[model samples]
Target: MLGQDPDAAQELMHSWAAQLSTRAQAAAELSDRVATIASSAVGANGAVRVTVGASGALTDLRLDDRVQRIPGAELAITIMAAIARAQAGLTEQVSIAVHDTVGTDSETGRAITDTFARRFPKPADEQPDRSERDARDGW
Candidate 1:
């Protein structure tokens, strides 16, 4: 008959429990930091305002009465731009949280930042090509 070592088994159980506790603490801290994330932006002379949550989801939007003076298309563009800016700000906050928790060089940190970068790309100044328009118009 083989006999089991009680002391060794007890030590192993304690080690596992400690590891689990440490992981739980880290997860809790990350959750708290993420919950604190909120970003906002104002657009077009404060005619439009936008706020985004930690995951870049829009949480709130406000339009000033002056927005009525702008054309519909222009107002739409301004609102969209504001939302994009707010999303970008949220991504920045998430990047900081990831860096603080997992280190920027770690695989987890890299994946998080990469995801945000791909999802919320930097805004660019885009205009229709004048040459194409002229050709189409036969000017």
Candidate 2:
């Protein structure tokens, strides 16, 4: 279906991705705001780290150290999901690491891991074949 109407598909996908990114950015902002929850809980003692970057067709998310204690995983998952949901082209890859300032619980890791794993699946049309279009359309 797309080979016969490549331009149309590309345009549709582009528009869809743009909308998704915009929404993801909005959601990122919200999640980032809440990301301080865990760090704040530890007051002056704890810190949270979050990094989000583009990795091919997926978004690479890393949350580590003291940040994992609060809402680090939740925030990371939120941002990842937002990006994956908003951008149809994105597949999510979220990684988390935590250090114990107080103590560690097995459930914490499981919870965050589960959250990342259980996020909603991406839609099929989100991953458009852009290679041919890039060569032909000069996009």
Candidate 3:
């Protein structure tokens, strides 16, 4: 009502429509980039390899012939580690893509990156021993 001259109202509506169109285009492009996201990693000594998709779902896995040299449990651990690394790589790619598309400071970008970061936290250097901590703290 404050700025409701007919021509001014028409111009304001046009500006709002243009802004919405731009956002729609940007979202579409981001979707396209995410749809193609993938990352791969190989385990130490090349015994295992893995690839993960945008959602951190495993798309491929490979085991070198040398994997037979390791015990079954060790080999399984190696494979799981490789898959985790691959998923981490995929999360990094998604973060970059979201930053590029929506700007890291924007609400959409922060939401996207924060979700991935929470879901795929960086591996810790060493896990704390709960028993040791409890003993030291007199728990």
Candidate 4:
């Protein structure tokens, strides 16, 4: 068949190469987007704000003047809670990035999402319950 219809096989190979290139581009785009992702959370009636990067590392923490009213130990707890809450959001943010870039149904998408979910799972207690969010929102 090589001599009978060589063009057919060449065309098929071209199509496969093109598909592979497209997928590689999509995966690179997804990686770029995920790398730039940052998630944040507020706690303690807006006294504390925490931001975490794609790796679930604390990139920023903000404490309002109201933090002065909170006891030292309590403020520590609030900040820690906010950090966990922020980390928990990393999975959601990555999922959105993955969906937008590669689609969640893809193997790459599922792997990336599952890794993030496992690394930054919602804190054991899912810190910052309804009351904490309400306070942060001034409710």
The number of the candidate with the highest TM-score is 4
Candidate 1, 80-105: lDDT as tens digits: 87777787777788788877775677
lDDT for 59 in candidate 4 is 92
- Model 2 agreement with the true structure over 23-139: per-residue lDDT tens digits: 566446434432432210111122322233322233233434544444555545444443455332211222223112111244433454346445534444432222333456885
Candidate models: Cα lDDT each: 0.74, 0.39, 0.74, 0.86
Pairs that clash in candidate 3: none
For model 4, the superposed segments whose C-alpha errors exceed 4 Å read: 1-4, 124-139
In candidate 2, which residue pairs get closer than 3 Å at backbone N, Cα or C atoms, i.e. clash?
20-86, 38-70, 48-67
Q: Order the candidate numbers by TM-score, best to worst.
A: 4, 3, 1, 2
Per-candidate RMSD, Å: 7.0, 24.2, 7.4, 3.6
Assess candidate 2 and give its TM-score to the true structure: 0.24
Could you give candidate 3's per-residue lDDT for residues 43-125 as a string of tens digits?
A: 64565778888888899888777766666776666667667777777668878888778778878778888887788666555
Residue-level lDDT of model 4, residues 70-109, one tens digit each, is 7787778888888888988999999998889889999999
- State the weakest 10-residue window (summed lDDT) of model 4: 125-134
RMSD of 1: 7.0
Q: Per model, how many backbone clashes are there?
A: 0, 3, 0, 0
Which residue runs of candidate 2 sit more than 4 Å off their true CA positions? 1-82, 85-94, 98-105, 120-126, 129-132, 136-139
